[model samples]
Target: RHPGWPARLGPLLVPVGRVALRPPRLLDGGAWSHVRTRDRAHLERWEPTSTVDWADRNTVLAWPGQWGALRGMARRGQALPFVITVDDELAGQVTIGNIVRGALRSAWIGYWVAGDRVRGGVASVAVALATDHAFNVAGLHRLEATVRPENAPSLRVLQKLGFREEGLFRRYLDVDGAWRDHLCFAITTEDAPEGLVARLIGSGRAQRP
Candidate 1:
């Protein structure tokens, strides 16, 4: 584990309005499974194809192993995996992965909200909170995200949070099977001196559930 990992990055709850981000708990399996199954079709287009059936009973039963692996990564300071909550109910997830220290203090952010929760600023608030934590608490200098051109909603989320378009990566990731091109977006601590969540709220764009 990294120094002060527990004290600095241990289980945390960041809340704003009706939205919150917290570590995924093993006990959340049933709720998480329910939401994922409900949003499978809504999410599959943007996500990589999975061999494991989300609706399968065994998948939900595997929560302990999955959660344990993620927890291990968190302990090693390699990732921050959080479940998005609305009014204390599980809504989706936001993850900060590929953490690199040394001279390059950076990571990548990814998130998904329940289909019913889309376009309601739930993703924006969850992402903004994650970004703030990545920059301020995680001590990361830069955060990046990638989105398919057709993913207008995701692009809007990045735009609203002020992520600058860096460039395009041809066939960057395998989504739903085939390699897909993605536009890279990034933000740095210097880019938001006032902090992302604060700026978002001040812009009168922060919507509560």
Candidate 2:
């Protein structure tokens, strides 16, 4: 079950077993280090922090504590932070930051796969799973994700997951060093009539996963 501040939610999730979700653990540090090292180059253009960001002795040491706190908030669904696992190994992280509820329940989805796992289809799987949770478990109507204009891989994943290109957000994020432009993508519960990935691919915008 998702661990968070609130005890429970009435609806918003379904059991997608096999690639089950779990709380992040201390043992993840070693996995994280490996991913960090592998993804440093691939992520250089899109991510704000780089190899230098983690290579520093100090920052690497502090990440666990900060990550733990954030992870906790995510598990409870108070915040949406999930570490993807394939065969019980840490593959990447997906987080729904800046959640806003009430009449309009929405959050922004952000994710990055470990360099080692880039082409294995994990990103699409994880995004779909998270999107399902956001709609069914979190009771959210909208799920949005953004990617750098040049990041074709990420764009493919979002499109594959049934997220539509809503628009382009210029200078949306500060990555590596400079502010970057991004293509905005979104998926509402209504858009996933044939399932997230299926609908996206069926609509002729995304590749089949």
Candidate 3:
């Protein structure tokens, strides 16, 4: 963690058509759990084993603490934790975590969407928006993301966002209880000075929501 970090983050929101990006709220625990439960099987193959039992209703009911912690990290300029919504319904989450300041000025981006929203251009738009926020609002220089080698949908999302493939990492992370290889991808502020969301829409890599 960097020293002298800000003590608070926001009240942040970014709108994109029917979709908007904002921080998680205490009242959203139930909705978040419902979406994740529905998508658990679908997400398992690509995600790491949960430290918490996601299927347990009681665990979900306790999410306000987790949400608060997420906001705390954001307040320190250590992360940007966001929930994506479509017409006020919780559709997904996009987080820019592992923030490094000083010489690095970078962070990692991660996200997941509701089962029904996969391939509906939600991921692309969400990624673009987060990328813009990282560079413009967070004042970061670079943002990175990694995908399991076999995760085609995730790869497509990064591609649409114009994240350049950096290389491959062997046994990069624990995923679904197994060590998995991953493909690294990244985008730098210098790579899209005009704003990544606008770039994606203009280049037609992703349509305006």
Best by TM-score: 1
Off by over 4 Å in 1: 1-17, 207-209
Clashes of each: 0, 7, 0
lDDT of 1 at 97: 86
Once fitted onto the true fold, the runs of candidate 2 whose alpha carbons sit more than 4 angstroms away are 1-20, 49-52, 57-60, 75-78, 197-209
Candidate 2, 41: how far from true, in Å? 0.6
Worst 10 residues of 2 by lDDT: 8-17
**CA lDDT, every model vs. true structure:** 0.80, 0.66, 0.77
Q: Judged by lDDT relative to the true structure, which candidate is superior, 1 or 2?
A: 1
Q: Write the per-residue lDDT of candidate 1 for residues 1-209, one digit (tens) a residue.
A: 65323322212222333778788888998887777777878887898756765566335777788788878988989988888887688888888888999999988999999887777778888888888888877789999999999999999999999999999999999887789999999999999989887877688766333
lDDT of 2 by residue, 48-120 (tens): 7445554552244655885778766665455777777755667677777667778878889887776755676
Q: What does candidate 3's lDDT look like per residue over 70-169, in tens digits?
A: 9899787788888888667888888889898889999999999888766667777778877776787677889989998788989988887789999999
Arrange candidates, best lDDT first.
1, 3, 2
